[model samples]
Target chain A: MAVATQDTAIRTGRFARALIYLVLLLFVLFYMLPLYVMLVNSVKPLSEITGGGMMALPQVWTLEPWAKAWSTAQIGVQPTGLRPYFWNSISMVVPAVAISTVLGALNGYVLTKWRFRGDTILFGLMLFACFIPFQIVLIPMAAVLGFLGLSGSTAGLVLVHVVYGVGFSTLYFRNYYAVFPTELVRAAQIDGAGFFQIFWRILVPSSGPIAVVCIIWQFTNIWNDFLFGASFASGDGAPMTVALNNLVQSSTGVKEYNVHFAGAILAALPTLLVYIVAGRYFVRGLMAGSVKG
Target chain B: MAANATPDFRTRLQTWLPKLVLSPSLAMVLVFVYGFIGFTVYVSFTNSRILPFVGPDGQPTHDLIGFTNYAKLFSLSHWEISLTNMAIFAGLYIVICTLIGLILAILLDQKIRGEGFLRPLYLYPMALSFIVTGTAWKWFLDPGIGLENIMQTWGWESFSFDWIKNRDFAIYTIVLAAVWQTSGFVMAMFLAGLRGIDNEILKAAQMDGASNWNLYRRIIIPQLRPAFLSAFVILAHLAIKTFDLVIAMTGGGPGRATELPATFMYSYTFSRNQMGIGASSAVIMLMTIAAIMIPYLYAELREKK
Candidate 1:
């Protein structure tokens, strides 16, 4: 009798586990539903989409929408398409990411290793910059850009991204270097190495993981930014997010849903790829960055 | 004697190099960050219209008109609606996200099958931009040709999911999209918190014949306070800065029903040429964010000390 009861308990336990998994699987589906819909609808021709079969797999698959989205779709009056904007985003992001990462590394090294009076206070001030709403600075930033004669230019956008981006980059590196061994710095210094020398040789070489985190974080943010891009850039200089917004919201002739989806996917492709490739580091970055949140 | 002089000079320079490298960042922050904030606050109090003008003498000028912009902002119906919408959006977004995130984290912590594939699948939306999410969900929620139409064709004849087109329901669609994009991130945060809990406590409770529900409710959930707080702070900030999502999804549309403060600020300052009022609204938003952030930062820094 005891054996039978034990068997029943085991059976119920297995059933309970299955139930938990089923719920989880349902959530996974819920999360993935939008992406599935995007891919399915994107590949289908307009005829099938309008046929009231949104979820059905495409019987006649074509790349025409993708092609048109890349080259022929009008973002505004310009039919040159998202191709230029894609490159525009790349140009802005690359320089912004590179310069900000290097500066953040230097700041982190100095703040952590070379402690001076009020250094923590200074670090705190920089950290505070990260959380301020971008709206507060929009009008003045525009004026600043205008004063510098960089209004409506990609370089202006780059400058905006780099300046705003420094806080986050510094936060990442500071936390990373705080727990890092100071013994190495002391040893290097005792060997007659100077500040930059110790940083470049000892600290920087060990910054592989945090560097990935910083670069990916900055790349995703700068690439995906719409507010700065929209405000600071205009025709021919707009980044992909702004361009995608215009393309999707543009009410011209027939709304090519396929083209819109393709354009959005293309615009999002890089960051999505980064997440897929290095998601572990991305999650680590978030944890480290927002641990005190 | 010459060698000693060289060493002394090198020591002084080395001490200053860290400061030298740090000074530029400090100066940029003072001007670009704090200075711009000061500029915005100053602009809010002035009667600047259309553009901030430069006088013929090449000095920028604005007429000082104190509290006029603030008064005007309170009287505007759109501003009232924007505040209402933010309350509704922020309230719902935070509650729903936290609940769903905690639940998902609990489920995932069960060490279910296919954890690896499931984790990233849930998190990939966070990788995509709000623009992409807004675009994708806009299509999904469109009544005529999206989910509603799809449901009708699936033989649910009375099925109607037209929230995207309904003004009253339109804001909810934004909530839907925002929740979808963010819940997984919250899950990751909670999951990290869950993993950090001491396993011996759980084992001890299990040995004492405590039920799973009791273990979670009595012990585990209480310990997730930090995670809960972090999630609230992050979500609240994201809720306030909800510009790109609303713009991409609805364009604050159906006759300004979904107009958020961020969108309002953009349109007023740049489009409508109401720079002073926009600046005022921007200042209000900064204050709101600062209210939450200042205390949070103080707690964090103090905890460290």
Candidate 2:
């Protein structure tokens, strides 16, 4: 009787474990469902997509949709495709990301290594800035941009992003440097090294990991930003997101679902590539931002 | 000897250098962040409309109209619909994300196989922007060419899944898409919290013959309060700032069925040319975000103190 009861307990435990696995797999399917739909639909031609079915893989796959999405898709009266806007995003994001990360690093160095009075309060204020809904600042920001003669300019968008992105990058680097070793700075000080000198030689050499985290975070945020892009930039200055939205929204001719899907994927590819390559740092950045806050 | 000597000019520069390097960021925050907020609040109370009226002297001007914009915002049916939709979206997003995330975290905590693959799979959506998520879901949810059409083709003959088009069900589609993008992030948080829990405590509970359910319910779950709170605050802010998703997916759509406050604010301020009303609505969003953020910030910062 004892043996039989133990046997049943083991079997039940196996069954329960199997149930957990099944549920997890189900969720994985559900999460991947939309992506799968996107991939399959993007490859199939418009004929197969409309005449056949949504889920069926194309009997003959084609990259035409991607080509169209990249070069021929129209938005409003402009048919310049997403290529120019893609470059616009690139130009806008690169400067913004580089500037923001540099500022964040410098800010982090000061906030952590050289503690001053009211620093924490100042940090608290910056963190508060990070979460304020951008809506509150939109109208005034437009006014400021116009006042500065930068309305609808890419350079203006870059300035806006860098300003807002500083809070996050600072938060990231500060948290990182808070736990960083301070003995290096002291030793450098003993060697008669100044602030920027010590930072360039000692701190920056070891900032590889955190810098990776900062750059990736800043890149993703600035690249994927639609609110600022939509509000601040337009016409020749519109980023890929705004252009993509206009493309999807404007349907003067036959609705090209294939091109739409391809465009969506193209827009997503940059951040996706970052996540794939350096996901560990990405998660680290996220946890630091979320958990610490 | 050097320490005892009078401080040199270079040393004094060192003392002030950090402040100088930090001043630019601080000043930017002051002018762009707080100053803009002040300006917005001022705009919210004015009679500014499509454009700020210019006075006879040629400078732009507006009469101080106390709470008139706010009153107009509250009375508008579109604003009311946006608020109602936000309430629904936020409520559902928080509750559903918490539950699903908790479950996924617990399941992953069991030391399952292929966690490496599954964790990233769960997290990849977070890498995509709301525009991508919205468009992807729009394709998958479109009645003619999406899941319903595919389902009908699969010989079910009656597999109806047209929530994206239905007015009563459209808001839920936003919930579904938002949850898909963020639940993985919530799961990651809970998973971290789970990992932080003391394993010896669990061992002790097991030694006391506690069931698995009791172990989670009585001990593990309580310890996850911080994670829960963080998730709630983050998700609440995301829900409040949910413009891109709504705009990308439904465009406040099929006649304001899925209108959110962020979308409402944008359309009113820029598109609909109701800048004052939009600014008022924007102020309301700020308050909502502040309601959740201020206390959370206080608690976190205070804990350090």
Candidate 3:
């Protein structure tokens, strides 16, 4: 009787475990459904889509949509495709990410190691700046860009991103360095090392992980930004997101769903690539960004 | 004595160097964030519309007209619709994301197999831009050449899922797309929270013959309060700042059914040239965000010290 009861309990436990796995699998399907749909239909001809075969595998796979989206699609009366705008985003994101990360490293260095009166308060102010709605600054920012003669320019977008992005980067580095040992800095200082030397030789060498996190976060943000792009840049200077929006939303077109999907995937490729390559850091960045030190 | 003087000077420079390095960022924040906010606030109080009111001296002017723009903003039907849509969208989005996040986090914590593969699959959407997510879903949800068509072709005749086109239900489609994009992020947050929980307590509860349901309800769920709070604040803010997705998916369309404050502010300020009213609307958004953010930041900072 004891053995039979134990056997029955084991059987029930297996049944429950199966149920759990089934539910998890269902969610996996739900999550993958849209991506699968996009990938499948993006390769098919327009007829397959309009013929109610959206969920079906492509009868004829072709790279034509991808090619067209890259170099020949009409966006806002320009048949320049997403090629220029892709470069626009690249130009904007690279400098923005680089400058913001460096500034954040310096700010993080000072805020944590070189503690002084009212420094926390100052850091608090910068931190609060990160969360403010951009709508509040849109008018002033537009005016400032125009006054500075950077309106509708990639350089202007870079400046806007760096200004807004420095906060989170600062937060990440500050939190990372807060736990770093100050004794090493003191030793380096006693050995007659200068400020920049100590940073470059001692701190920066060990800052590899946090730097990756900061760079990835900043890259994703500046690359994907649409509001600033739409507000500040226009015409030939629009970034990929804005251009993709125009291509997809153009009311006069034949609703080229395959081309739109291809363009979206192209727009998404950089960040998605980064996420896949360094997803662990991406999650760390996301967690660090949210949960304050 | 000269050598001693050099060391002193070096020490003084070192003390100031950190501040010197920090000053530029400080200046940028002050001017760009705070100063610009001040400028926008002033604009809201002025009579500037389309362009800044110009004085006889051939310069832009700020002729203050107290509360007129705000009064006009409050009286607009478009503004009313945007606010109503925001409340509904935010409420449903937060609740659904939280529920789904908590459930997924708990389930994933059950020592399941293939955990590594499953987690990132859930989170890839967070990595994609809202525009990309919006584009994918817009077509996926379209009645023609989309889910409805596929369902009808699959012999589910009379099937209808045209919420994307219907004004009354269009807002829910936005909610669906949003929740899909963000629920994974919330799940990550809650999962982190779950992982951080003290396993000793869980072990102790299990030793006391607690059922799994009771263990979660009585102990595990309570421990996730901070995660819950963080998720709420983040989701609330994101919901308010939702412009890209709406613009991509619906363009606040079907006659402004999904009009949100962010979109509203953009169209009014940039397109309609209602600069003063737009500034006023932005100020309202800022106030709402501040009300949530200020307290959270204060508590987080205070607790640290």
CA lDDT, every model vs. true structure: 0.87, 0.87, 0.89
Q: Give each model a TM-score.
A: 0.96, 0.95, 0.96
Name the candidate that leads on lDDT. 3
| Residue pairs that clash (backbone atoms under 3 angstroms), model 1 | A293-B230
**Chain A: TM-score in each model:** 0.94, 0.93, 0.94
TM-score of chain B of 2: 0.95
Interface RMSD of each: 6.9, 6.8, 6.9
Across A1-293, the per-residue lDDT of candidate 3 in tens digits comes to: 00010111011267778887888888898888888877887788889899999999999998888888999999967798899999999999999999999999999999988889998889889998999999999999988888789999999999999899999999999988989999998999899998889999999999999999999999998889999999999999999999999999988859999999999999999999999999988888887877754
Which portions of model 2 miss their true places by more than 4 Å?
A: A1-12, B1-7, B51-57
Which candidate would rank higher by TM-score, 2 or 3? 3
Candidate 1 C-alpha lDDT tens digits along B1-305: 99899989999999899999998888888788999999999999998876546877887777889999999999999999999999999999999999999999888777566777788888888778999989989988888789999999999999999888888989999999999999998998888778778777877887888888888898889999999999999899999999999999999987888999999998999999889999999999999999998888778877865
Ranking by DockQ: 2, 3, 1
- Model 2 per-residue lDDT tens digits across residues A1-293: 00010111101267788998999999999999988878888898998878647788887799999999998888646677789999999999999999999999999999999998899899888889999999999988888888789998899999999989899999988887888889989998999999999999988998898899889988988888999999989887899899889888886889898899888888988998999999888888877778862
Best by DockQ: 2
Cα RMSD (angstroms) for every candidate in the order listed:
4.4, 4.7, 4.4
What does fnat come to for each candidate?
0.65, 0.71, 0.69
